[model samples]
Target: MYSEIIRLKELGLNISQIARHLDISRNTVYQYGNLNPDEYNQVLEDMQTRQKKLDHKREKILSWLKEYPDLSGAQVFDWLKERYPEIDISESTVRNYVSYLRKEYDIPKTIHKRDHEAIEDPPQGHQMQVDFGEEKLKNAQGNLVRLWFIAFVLSNSRQKYVEWLDRPFTTEDVIKMHENAFFFYGGRTKEIVYDQDHLILTSENSGDLILTHEFANYTRKRGFLIYMCRKQDPQSKGRIENVVGFVKKNFAKHRTFFNLERLNEDCLAWLERTGNGKKHNTTKKIPAEMFALEKPHLLPVYEKLNSTCKNSITRTVRKDNTIWFMGNRYSVPLGTYDGTEKVVEVMKVQENILVISDLETKQELARHTISLEKGKLVKNNNHGRDRSKGIDKYIETVAVFFNQPSQAKEWLKKIRAQKPRYIRDQLQMLQRSIEDVDVLITEKALNYCLKHNLFSATDFNDAIDYFGKMQPKERITRFGEADFIEIKPLNEMDRSKFETKPMTRDFNYYKEILERGHIC
Candidate 1:
């Protein structure tokens, strides 16, 4: 073919004319015209030499493919480099050589390729993409630990934000991370694109996506639309997908992970100094700089959206008036538990404090500082105490109920001095007894009992019964003319008589009347 193109060119034919005469493409004619006899011989010799360059390694590569047919070209290249470090070859060279060997040796092609199309960037502050990734790294304790991270990238500016977690992200974690990302960017985009992760999307029904309750509530409050990508289509959110891989390769690779806090601190600093600050390959401008221009176009964050993004969990209050939270127990009000399970809402408001509230009313029940150790019992001292039945209040109620303040104080002092351990029980008993008895009767009974230094509830009741029986009864008597003084008009006779002392009744007369059995 080279000779024919050369012969046509020598017959006074231009490049296109030669291509037509030789029945070849113009590119082929030009390529042949550029090569002379000596260069063609040199190229043949170079091809011969290139074929032998991997003559020894070719057997090894074939053997490796026979043993592990699923090995990728990159993996095979890495293996070759490790075994033959002195070999001078580019990855493309190795890849091409491997492909030729696969075809020549009839090695089965095990790798599959998927087609992807490039996506154009959205308008500034119009869209963001979010995704999660995990890596296994050596921790500070020299143990291999798996860490997860969430990545958020603005579609236009390529501004990246990442949050590292030591565990898999739950729905709450996802929302909290989104809040952190939004705050990091100083605003939010109109829409956020996400993968079909369970933390966000629960299901798809009739072409409508069912988002998780937490994420739905979060988007509704934050006033942002969510776009869920199709399953297995990572290229839909290719910006964040590339960012995740970039983070792992550039930031997390070969890095020592001490703790979650320290790791996150270093991650943020890296993002400021390098990740967002450095020039992006696609945008060709620093992400931080582009983000400055994009900020004004972002959606204005409302004040309501600035509310806490803490994770909330529902816990059942145990019979001991305590609820389990983050592997620790925290006390609630005494009546918060009803011997049965009582559901309470708990939120980790801060690193150390958890706010517990009534699930139905959302009324805050207690705030407890979280314990550092697991299985610990963290309690507020006043949580389970009966506020209405304190010792001092009990004494006051008893004193007022019995109309004997001094005696009540004295009785309490005696009980405290004699049986101090039972003082609370005694006071509680007295307070409860007063609820069932009348105030006047209780007062009389208490007075009688206190007179005898008897403080027991049974003694007070007995005294009350005895006093009730010993009380005098009323008798009816018919009035005669002697019992009644003549009712004269005040003007006639009462003016002078009112000034005079009335004649006193004789005791002997009343005694004689009683003795005569006429009193009845």
Candidate 2:
């Protein structure tokens, strides 16, 4: 305090002694050593009420800090600059103001902070790092569309490959992207490094990595080793991490997304020009040129995959549960046939393996080796098996609703024989009609239908309705085992009272309706 300083000075205590007694810095004590109490008090007042450039945005900055306490000064700087571009200021000034706010508000240091150590680059063709990144870009429609990309970078050369998708990545997507990335490099490294991403890993069981099924299969098939970094440890796989950020900031930053195909094509071109063609910031060597020296050391891939080739094609399931592609018929599940032709995705992966899957569920329906000969049927035996099972059980269940179960079953079998493809539909229709009709009327209709050999459900329904609604619910008690319930012919319902006697009118009830304009 200024008063304390003057009191200490009057006591003949030097600046060093005063600083020690007050626990203030010697610099601070010397600066106030010669100033009078009035000047010191004025300085204190100015320090207390000093205005800040970002004071107008204090609330917004505080909320951001409170919500994302781990956000760095640089991130906050970028966010403010992005959202409010008109705000003219330097990053250092924003950082100083942010520090001031943090001290005044008593917020603490962030969590999940980790140490970073520089690592030596792996030898050529020995290692590559892979990771995923996402960004929102303006589409052709000028709407913000979020896109994801899996990035790969060779550790020695910094050669990069990126594949983008409008949707989130899946395990299969990871595999496909890996193939394209390796193909772009002409060969693959012996080992690949990555974060413990869920798409590739199901769990980290202590130290043992359990990969997702598809990714595990793809890894084994490709004969490559994977090293997944520990949780929150980006330092181990920093190459791909930098590549992901570089792709987002450099290539995809302001690029308007037209489509996945166009975006990826542009990305490949960007890599050839700006991404790998220029000198890398750290290595100070062109990545593409380095790749030429490293390519010979890479493990040769079994085949060259053209990234431009479409991954899959949509095929309409035929009525016979077959899809015609490349002049061959491939059978899907039997129930795949529907009133409206259902479509399935057919992906050809690794030679002739046709991976057919449902469009919505993405579950593989069938896998077949494509037939070489045209007009050949590449069928899985299970696919051609009868899809309708337990039909007998369904028939027996329906028969229990009728009084004469045996007769009902026989008639149902006849319907099944007549409509083999639609027996289930027929049985369902028959059961619905039985629910509304009286039992006696149902029996009479069933017997009449059997006698007339009417195997059609529609004809049977007509017979049930035409069985003369003579209080049919009450008519059940009127009929006995010994009594023969006589029913009229199918075409002859008793319409004696219902029928109107034909009266010869001159013309439309004396043309009154026409005069009145009652008929259109």
Candidate 3:
């Protein structure tokens, strides 16, 4: 072919003409034409001869291949370099040589993966695997909201239960969900397996598992065995690993963000419809059907589980909202000093965490670490400077931007109460949101939030932009209909806790908004 191309090129033919005459491609003609006779002869010789410069190591490579069929070419290259440190050969060259030798000797590389056995399931109700998974879902407002979830799978039956949270899981959250899962599955398994999640296990001392103090207390209270699998051992917890992926792919994938309640409802529905209701791909058994056999074997769910704050002591709330604990006055959230609620129950959790709860309601109020010296005010960074009066002032100032100061202030108070930890940031955000927007729009946003019981500053900001995007016709039509388009709470917060005023406003703003789309 090369000779024919050369003859055609010599016969006053261009690459295309030569290609046509020789019945080959133009690239073929160009390729041969680009090299002179000596270079072309060298190329031909190189193509015909398979003797790599590094082919002398064929004996060693073949021996290694016979000894270790699973050895990778790169490993062989490393071995060669180790044996002959002075050998000058590129890794690619060594790889090529190894490839050539393997083909010549008919030795194919085999990968050695761990052998999987068809292990039988544990006795019915003996074990349930636990794991967590998270995904981001877009809400109606087109905001990216991430939700974390923990899933439980019965190893014997492949039965499943799952719960979701809009925030990171605390030990308390985990315990609560575990209780819910127990209720869902009808009973607790003999041993629950889990990944070494920091929420539960603090550290593994030698062979002993050191669980977090709160979790340890719960475990002792509940009386179930915990089997934490080591990191990276997915196979040990394969059942729950599959459940995690199944939840992420089957249930949570591309699902819209609502409240945690709705997400869990959808997940439970899916588990009934497909997750456990479907036949297992591996065992060829339907999980719900299998769970019937497993349910009776499960141990009875513990009755009368105590509040997570076990072994707690009552402490008097000082006038400063600090609680007396071991001679130190640690600050609670600013209104914990209300005369009606004079005391809080304090519990010492792991890592010196102080969990303060309402003495009567037992609802957790604040969590802080014991950091300061005795007699020094150990105010948690979470509870910042006294801002009740200032927050009211800030809310009023932001509300004044809208037409109804009292309504806006009440709505803003809802925001402050709902997001007490982030009140300052939320107020600042509300102020920024109303700064450049139209007053009618801010008022509409505020009313929209109030009407829908949306007490979030973020939601308020979204409401402003939501209204601002509409035409005057859309403004009036959308304003009334917008009340129906409520966003699911980012966290499942109780709106009843917020003191709201009647959504009564003067008709003049709407009368102006009704005019030819102008802010008259």
Candidate 4:
């Protein structure tokens, strides 16, 4: 072929004219024309020898295909592509080369990989791939729980981000995963390619694409487009599909977690250690290292897409007037003093604190301490016992006339039995009598009534009035010298023994009739 092209070029033929005559590449014709006749003859001989060698290899491939008709030509071509070092040929050329060999060596043609199309290359940063996988966990009951982990990987960098959540692969999880992927990528991609699920992209009976409202909002907010492959056509996002298998085999295999949060933390750490740490297969650089370079140039994360998740639940106060949180209950102000429904705003910070507030007005009333102990009810000890009404206050009230420690103890015990009720009236009655009578006599009356159960101050006053009217009663001014029997009655019978004289002076008849049952 080179000699023929050289001969044609010697006859004043251009490269295109020589290529037409020789039916070869223009460059090959040009090279042939540039060569001397001796060199051209040597190239033609080498080409003929190479063609013979290819004929032998092609005959062997064809013979193998004839013997095993199940074998595909593309499979043989793949083998030849790897086996033949000197041959640089396209599949078509190889096919034609094999056909010529079949004609010369008497072999057969086999099936070719004509039905399959070459995979299309994804545009850089144009698509994000997502999938789901499983991880195992031990629940509170110690039973094994299989958790679903949502995974997303950039098609270009193979930078993967994952989350292990107890919630199913629902709409919320899908949206949340997308949000996290954007943040993980430090920006948005031109398009998000996802598995065709009802949570994300669904087809209605009417043939309309029923995209989730939240996902639509996300796309609109981030200025990114969405892409969904045909059902079951996993090749649509083969990047993440392969990533899914990679993660399952490497990170998730034989792994056990106690909680979803801990697993997610581990997943992220693994992503940093493996996904972003190693050189990519195609790029020959670390995925994480490449991601860093790609991140700054990607579209910025949308400000409207909130990353926070809020949880709201209602709680009630226990009998101890404390609301339970986390595991413990802490006291709010007693009575919720403001009335109506009282609420506790539990803001989770370093620890959890209940912002005690009046629900009617939402006014913050008090801030209680954070609690963690389960079922632990923390009381407001300072307010539980009102210090203003302490035992000392009651003791000081009675210490005025009773000044004796023994009498004060007795009075305090009696008053405590009645609680704070009626204690002031009893103290006032004692102070009034202390001024008119000797302290000893008033103390005697108090002890007599306490012993005989005449706790009423009015009954004690009647006894004192009766004793004052006694006829010709010998009196001792000094407390120690006074007639002790008259001053202080020892028993109930003794108290009744001293009575008013019958028919005091002259009672009016009508007034007497009103007291007809009386001895007077």
Number of the top TM-score candidate = 3
lDDT by residue (1-520, candidate 2, tens digit) is 7678778988999989999999999888778878977887899899889988898989999999988877788888999999999999889988887888789898775888566767777888999998989899998888999888999999999999989998666556777788888788999999999897766775677888877555666777788998989999887777788888889899988889888899999999999999999999999999999999999999998784333423565667888899887789999988987867476767888577888888668899999997878999889878866545678889999898788889999999989988999998998998898875566788888899989889988998898878855444344521333232556668876787688787777786768877778654
Best by lDDT: 2
User: 1-520, model 1: which lDDT tens digit per residue?
Assistant: 8788778778878998888777878897777798999987897788777755577788899998888877778988899899888988888877887888888888887767887777777999899999999998897777888899999999998888999999657567877777788777888999999997766775655559876555677888888888889889887778898999999999999899888999999989989998999999887999999988898898875543443434665666888899876578899988888865466667777777889887667899999887879999988878866544576676676666655567767776665566566777777766676664444556677777768887665676687667655542321122212332345566675476668896899899989989889746
- Between candidates 1 and 2, the one scoring higher on TM-score is 2
Ranking by lDDT: 2, 3, 1, 4
> How accurate locally, in lDDT, is each candidate?
0.78, 0.83, 0.80, 0.63
Over 1-520, each residue of candidate 4 has an lDDT whose tens digit, in order, gives 7567756766887888777766788988667667887876797788776644455575567666677755555666777878776667667666666566556666555546635455654655766777887667556576777677778887766778887777446455566677777777778778777776655653432445555444555566567776777787786677888787878878877676667778778888988888678777766878886676567657777553663322222344545566666567667666653343334433333345456554335565456676656677766665354643655565575555553656645755565466556656665675475555554545555666677766555655665555555533544443357554345456546545467567655568668777876865
The deviation in Å at residue 341 for candidate 1 is 30
* Model 3 misplacement above 4 A: 1-50, 56-94, 106-110, 302-304, 310-520
Task: State the number of backbone clashes in model 3.
Answer: 0
Question: Where is model 1 poorest over a 10-residue stretch in terms of lDDT?
Answer: 474-483
Taking all chains together, the TM-score of candidate 4 against the true structure is 0.37
Q: What residue pairs clash in candidate 1, if any at all? A: none
Model 1 TM-score (2 dp): 0.41
lDDT of 3 by residue, 110-213 (tens): 87689888789899989988998989999988899978999999998999998889965766778888888888888998898989876677566665997766
Report RMSD for candidate 4: 34.2
